[model samples]
Target: MITLFRSFFQSKLGIGITLAFLGLIALAFASSDVANTGTFGGVAGGETVAEVGGTSIDTAELRSTVETAYNNERSQNPDLTMTQFIEEGGLERVLDVLIQGAALVEYGEKHGIVISKRLIDSEIASDSNFAGLDGNFSEAAYASALRQIGLSDSMYRARLRQSLVANQLLAPAFIGSAFSENMAVRYAGALRETRKGKVVSLPSALFAPDKDPTKKQLDEFYASNRDRFTIPERRVIRYVEFDASSLKDIPAPTAAEIRARYERDADQYRASESRSLTQLIAPTEQGAKAILAKVRNGQSLAAAAEGTGLSPSDLETERADYAEASNAAVAKAAFEAARGKTVGPLRSPLGWHIVTVDAINSTPARSLADVRDEIVATLAEEKKREAVNQFAEDVEDGFASGSTLAEVASELGAEVKRTGPALSDGRIYNTPDSVPEILNPVLSTVAVMEEDSDPILAEVVPGEKFLIFDVAEFTSAAPPPIADVKEQVTAAWRLERGSVAAKAAADKIMKAVRGGKDLDAALRSLEKKLPPIEMVDIPRSALTANSERVPPPIALMFVMAKDTIKKLAAPLNVGWFVVQLDDIVPADTKRDDPEVATFRTNLGRGAGQEYAEQIDNAIEAEIGVTRNENAIRAVIEQLSGSGR
Candidate 1:
């Protein structure tokens, strides 16, 4: 059901419909009735961020909305930072959505568009989130879910009421919309258009200087881009890890314990009956009967199947248990048939099948001795995990009671480990070996912590160990002497010079092509210095920005006038390419084409949404909308946890 819902939501028309109310739904789930304490016309109340018509949008509500939006984004991308969230305009987006919803609600109230209490109650009662084990609405479950998110019953209902009213007001605009077939045909034709072109790449390696860079040239390059050579702040982290694998005192499981476990889970060790089956599906009942008769008369099954004109793959030979077979009738016949016996001309949903049981496999239960060692190892690991968890708790308690990491390690009789100075990006200086797996948590912890702060506890290896670490010393970012980075500077200088030359060559080729010369002819002029040119007919859908056959700038071809030449430098230090548009093939726009229908439906929904937005804007203008800029900025800072 969830998969079905997602498929519906992803359809072309469904996408536009969802966009119309997606923000409203998000705001509804994130909002509460904190604004209800003040009257609709009140001038003073709790801190307010905005006013729609005469109603105030409280600061508390806006903060909750931002936090919810941030959490939703982070749930999709776990590594997203608060700084990145703000930089992506998460706060402004949420505010605009909430404000738009507010405007819709105000307009609804003025026009007397209201949802009944019974309707709201029915909607809440049918919600799956409020359903209990018996699949009935449970008040306790409903209250608990709302409480977990800091929403009261009245607050939740108010948001729902607003959503219902807005839906009612917008339904007319969406339902009354229509799109023409001509418009759909035109749009789909543009999307399915294919372009045939040739690309000639100018490799930068061909333009490399024969000699190494002079000292003066290297020094000059380093002087101009010294900031690029500056190293970020590095930290030396000292830590002690409590590892489960280091527990040596756990006792092995006895024979009796192993036997008891085997008995408790005996069904898991039992194997189902399986058969090796080779089946030949016939196209007709008469053909199947003929094949079966041939097999029964001592002809080989493969030979009989070949007479029916079925390939080896079409025969579908493999091993399967009763449940694993393609259909129930085939499974039952295969299991019941004697080994080396041929059975069927049985009609399944697919076709008439004739099967031969080549082999039958039966598994017998084993004695406890067969798995004694595995059980013993499992018991030992469980004991070790418990011991490690206890030690981790003790270390955490020690830190809480004012003991340093070193002191805690001493108390536990564990050795403290120190890492070499490492940059914030996790690079260690002058180290021959890579960073140990266990030290990853320590590096991440110290990267964000203030210098000389208290030791922090973290799970370095989930379910196996914990690390207590602190930054022992810190080194701020600074540029090293040019002599120290001379090798790197020389490589950078060469790459820069090579890239410039490649672009210059590509530009010359582009100029020639624009002057009526063929692409191959233009490249042949520089044949000694260029690689072989490859041409491919790329459909518009296949011309993605990340295509391996074409550079990202190939997207420019669609926008350029036909028969024009263009040049683009490749990303990531690759060479440049000169591209020319040859011809375009537009899609067929027959009435029966599925793409045309989809495009028509999508365009209609898009037009409806545009009309809806215009309605919202006109409503806002009719009843003035004012916002408190200072309050909004303060709320943003608070949600980001950088409040001054």
Candidate 2:
């Protein structure tokens, strides 16, 4: 069975991933010979994915790694099945991952990096995922887990050691240098303060006909800044997008077809002896007996489940197939004893348990006749999906040959919707007040396109239907004649005049206030907020939008000498604001301020992240990633071959 996996791994995706896995566990595990792996379990000696110099990684081990991942996934998703997991490229994906790990481990050894055994133990000990109810790594729990996967500590440790060594080889490049202290202070200050300023805004709609600018002025502005108005170069394109939803029903699996499948794969529908069990445990042997007595005397399960202490009953419950004895400790004892039987006072690690079998629900495998309809429906949906994909492609092809969006939509029964010519800055498409964030990025792509292009595939919500757009025409942007924007130009001119006026007004008020003129009296003629003198702490990311804010300029006024007096400037966005920075807060060394400390720490981490990114770029460049994107479509096409 392990040998059957060879052809897939022989490919780069497979071999590369497999090598990574070997590289992870190669050091102490000694990949001497590849072991045979099967869906049922692992056995020694099988075909190898690769040999790290003299070391070999077994096919069985590769399968086991996949099984571990499967089990881990199922732990989160109770609805997932092993069979479904296998079919969704889950098994192949797992093998590739393991191989990559092996390769990394091999790479480390070839480079002379070493991972100590103590480090491997520390990793296991620190893994909260593997901890017991006591929040500690229980040896018994660990052993039980390994037993289910047919791995000994020695085997598991070997892999862990190799993984660490490989990581060690890579970590230095990722953390090339320590962060500077100067960066930390700057970062901390930026995060700890917010700039406060008053603003005056110019509404484009406010420009009136009387104030409209001349065509000469408008043309001069347009001519001088042509690049701002120029649209990006775009290509007209046509492409067929293939996705699971693009197709419709799978192949037509008729009654006979369904029957044949069900007959051939009846074992797939078999039901196992799964049990839902509850347990009551106590500390000492005598305490176990006492707890069993209490449970027998009708103590509540909740009371039995209280925290670790004397007279406390530790309650444990798990759901698992009866044969998987490790998933439920006490249930195994009860199942062995008999249905409706009160078993021990069983002697297990945490304490003793009073176990009872509430009910025995035995199930048998489904006969082919029972699930035939289901099999047919499943096969049909798959074929339908494939057909849908084919139809979409046909529609795209027709449009590419000079058909319109309406024509394509009419043929494929796809809906047609239109949005504005959104810009690439993501502003017009996705304003804070209008349009969706998802739509912005897609619309931005559409914004610059000049082509009678392919239907744009817009990302909808995750794992949901996508939106496709076909461009019919593009309205290339050209500067409108000033006559066309007469009203707008007039309004803009008024605001420009108001801005200059406001600065003069603010200057007079500020000087009078500073010269001991009544502060409230000085504000009489201005439309500014009165002195509540409020303050706020906001990060640098929140403060700056484009350029200089009033906070710094205002702060400068406080310590300004006689020669440097100038009128206060008003902000461009809102009502009149006067800024005054009262104090300069230094970075406090208080340990209680985790926010400050964490900001500093993140700056350090940012340096490492930058280095890691650089190394990733170098590796990718070295590897020369060639994407035959057409091949991807070919593979998907082959899988969705049955266009029902």
Candidate 3:
């Protein structure tokens, strides 16, 4: 639950909680009102879904949290539907999280654990999502993110405060958990245990009925499992594209304007000279004179400064600029010296200076005519950029004043193009490659918008190209008609029925094996042609090797007692499996082994998680939790009906 909350609320802000503190604190606050029953479709008192102490979680709050979680999940999996999410227990999970959060906050306050506003402010200020280009927190970015996620300031702050208080309450329990050495040794021994078994496969295809499903049966199956056949929502976008190239009437830079710009930057065109030098600044005049005398005696300045644990520094600057930065006397002496010549042990604000001139560079003064072409190009580019920006602003203002996208495009003398229907993932339906590159960026943006939403101006290529777009058509995610997907529905119905038959076959085989018959003999007894039985010997450690998932039959075999048989269902309606455990080899791990020490540390972390869960339950029970079952059910149904 903590992971879920953090992933949803802290996604944009990049807030994180380290594992050393409260990462193991998984709170699952199952409500005590499971038996509380009411009408299935009516709103209850004040529409409250749950109550923790004096705090009431109303339906609106519950709905918002559920929506946020659902949206966050959808960002990763576009095919997820509200019905599928609810059926997988998302609604109950979110409600449990909310109830637990409220309980923790209220319990903390009762125990004198206070969360200050300034602390919450610091958390917000440190979040990178709200930071500006300069890396400081920006109010505008913060507000915009809040609007995008549909969270208000107070709501976000309350969540942050609750998080802080919960961490304070659970820290001790999480940090203090430990596993003894003896316990660690026992766990390591278990990991080294091995099992031997015999297994048989019952493929679903062999059990499937020969006849095809009827229309009536297929319809019922499709209706019951609409989520399996439902398509994701898609939209058709209509947009107008414009860029700096679209404006053909920008005035060229005038000759007078070019001359004026040159005058404005007169220093750039003025005659100037700069020298590159290697100078060593010494703290004492005596040391400076010594280094200068060495250089004048044919020693390089760098070599002379080696005795002082320093070296000459290289610099290139105009004479006047260097004079203003250092001493005028130092600059004059350095500049007057010929290339490859050494100069003065002079004094400046920094210290005594020993200078060596490396090279001289001079720039001749230029008239206005010499820089005319350069100035004209610079001015032309600037004007074009400004005009493009102003034009986009005008279009935005026009939108704010209620102008339609067509009107804006027509007035701007640009063409408005419409795209075929496309999904939120940017794939055009029935024509994958037909979507223009210009519309690619806005496809996902416009996918969620209402048809009546104002045209959005998107800078596709920064200042170079932009698009103003709106949704032309919207098709909400839903199951296609039974007629349109009969073949798929029929295939699904057959697979489901076949899975049931396969489970029965697996059960019969297991019963026969448990009844003292050999595994091969039991397979021979079955009159139907069945898959051959296979023998296996596997070490427990091998099941977890390389972090790969253990195959179902092998995993089930390891958990069974010796000489026992169990039936296991395969995933994805593929088949069923039966395993008979034949032998068990007990592990004999030495106490001094390195793996034992590692096991102790890992097992202690698991124990810490158990401790955290206990604390969560105790806090909730002390605070007193009650939930409105009918209200929660109604909210779930409403959200499912909305097809979010």
Candidate 4:
């Protein structure tokens, strides 16, 4: 999910996504409760962030939270930053969370739910991932965690408390709404057996050649499903960067260390060995003796397995993964023999075995000279990575000595290029295909930095091939005036119209299904009869529409025990989600299929989700959430001008 945060939150403002992901959860404080701020979501100096709901959600808190989350995330993404976070929907997600949190807090208030400090503290203490394995809170670690994402303990704890209060109230309420066993069984059966008749796709060639898609047809599609084409608003930003690689006279790794690293990784540096062999396992020692005696007399291993009441395990293992002393009597004799040689009337616990080595292969062992090129490449990359950091330190010193970017650039043997208005994600300028991964982490740390001023991290951006990045120009995201997207509004209007038609049609079908019309026949009567559907075995990853190549959603479908005849809604980018529950296959663990284990896991998740959703809902219903759009816009604008 943080990976998603990285890409989606990639923005010009260094912290928009990065800091958002870090501290956004922390920001979910009762912003509505933040007092004297007069408005919600405004940025000032480092200390000047505002709040909502009379609660304070500031930059410092957000920063702390971001740091903590990133530190946790470091296990997986060791080199990710707030800039990448925002570029990847990190900021947008935060906004969504802020809205949800506000709404929940208000809802909680409305419902008279009160969360106590004790409950919140207990929760904090109990969350093992947040706490250490020592089973006691390490205050420094906790504080450090909060600080990483830019939060203070006092502020975050309150938000956490409110969140808990809301959860405590709703989980029981949602428990009553959970699916019954009968329902689950029915659902599972349907899913397991659900078959949509095979669809023979009319090739795109058919449409392309026979009937060129008319403008009218495209328009009709657009009209019928405007939601599909209405992409979210995107921004293009420009910013400057400062990174570890922008300095001069950086030190390089010594040759000795490079050699040491190569030695350390020698096992990985070497290729694997392979062998082919044939073996027979006999049910009895006498049976093995019979086979081995024949092999000694010159019978092939395969024929030996067939003739001696022994089956060849076939081109089997030359070496056991672990030594089995019982099998050692047979194997030791076998390996000691040369290839194509027969051996082993050897004794074993599983009986007797006769063996023949067919072929043995050892990968080309890399000689020092043969691997010299790769060694050089490895040593150079390591040297440069280390050197770049050292270079950054030198750049700092150079600045103290009154040197300029040009002088630093010249000294470092790095070229300079000015980037257009681009954001941290590098997507603003149609991110080139050849960008270096090292430069990807941070485009710039401080978004609102002043021009003509030397910033600490300005040279921090890694180069395109090595480590390169540019400063960003950030901007505020505001809801566009309706007039700015009149066509979009018109498209939305069309989708709304289409949705109304689809829903009405579905309602008629539902009524007919209840009135004794067969579900399939009812569907057939629609303006477009169901297309021939496909039957497929799909993995879970293939279920989404995007993975239609794997297991496409059929217009018609079915499952195991119970049955549902329901209307699926018109699909949307977000709103098009539809599920028509039908039939339930009984869960069977003994089945050879792996999906059973998957189903069991899913079942457990279903239980957890029920609890989690209830908590979310209860919070929403209990809290008081209000939006100060203007304030939020101002914050975005203000933060856009600054860098982290």
Q: Estimate each model's TM-score.
A: 0.50, 0.37, 0.64, 0.38
lDDT per residue (tens digit) for residues 1-644 in model 3 = 23454443332111322221111121121111221234323544257889899998877666655655665465567677778778887777777767777888899999998767766776677777666444556565565445334456875677678877767766445332457888889989888898988888888877878899876887788889987888788778888988757766889998788888889879778998989988777767887888788888888987776424345679887786577546689999988989998887888855777888899999999988887877776677567655665776787798888888889888768899988787766678757455788886655456447676777776676446878888888888878888888887777787788889989877777778778777777777656688777888888899888778888899889889998998888876778888889999989898889787678766765665566667778999999999888888888888788645
Tens digits of per-residue lDDT for model 2, 354-411: 6666556556778766766666655564455345445546655775787776665554
Candidate 3, residue 157: the lDDT equals: 73
Tens-digit per-residue lDDT, 1-644, candidate 4 = 12323443333212211222222343222111122223323454244333444544544334333333333343345234444454554444555554445555555666676665655665565555354333444343354345323355775665575555434443333221233344445445545443322222222111122223445654565555543343222223222334444443544556676677568767635765444657665655776787677677777765654412224655534244212423566666766678788777665644455667787666766755666666565555445544654554676687678876556556656665444444334344334532333444433222222244343432222221333232333343223444455566455545454556555555665677668886566656664533443333332222443734432234333331134444344344111212233433333323434444344434544554455555555554444344455544555544333332
Q: State the C-alpha lDDT per candidate.
A: 0.64, 0.46, 0.71, 0.45
Judge candidate 4 against the unseen true structure and give its global Cα lDDT, from 0 to 1: 0.45
lDDT of 1 by residue, 241-277 (tens): 7765555476676677777767875754566555677
Q: What are the runs in model 3 whose C-alpha is more than 4 Å off?
A: 1-46, 152-154, 211-227, 237-401, 407-419, 430-471, 527-535, 546-548
Model 4 alpha-carbon miss at residue 108, Å = 34
Best by TM-score: 3
Best by lDDT: 3
TM-score of 4: 0.38
Native-to-model Cα distance after best TM-score fit, residue 356 in candidate 2, in Å: 30
Instruction: Locate the minimum summed-lDDT window of 10 residues in model 1.
Output: 1-10
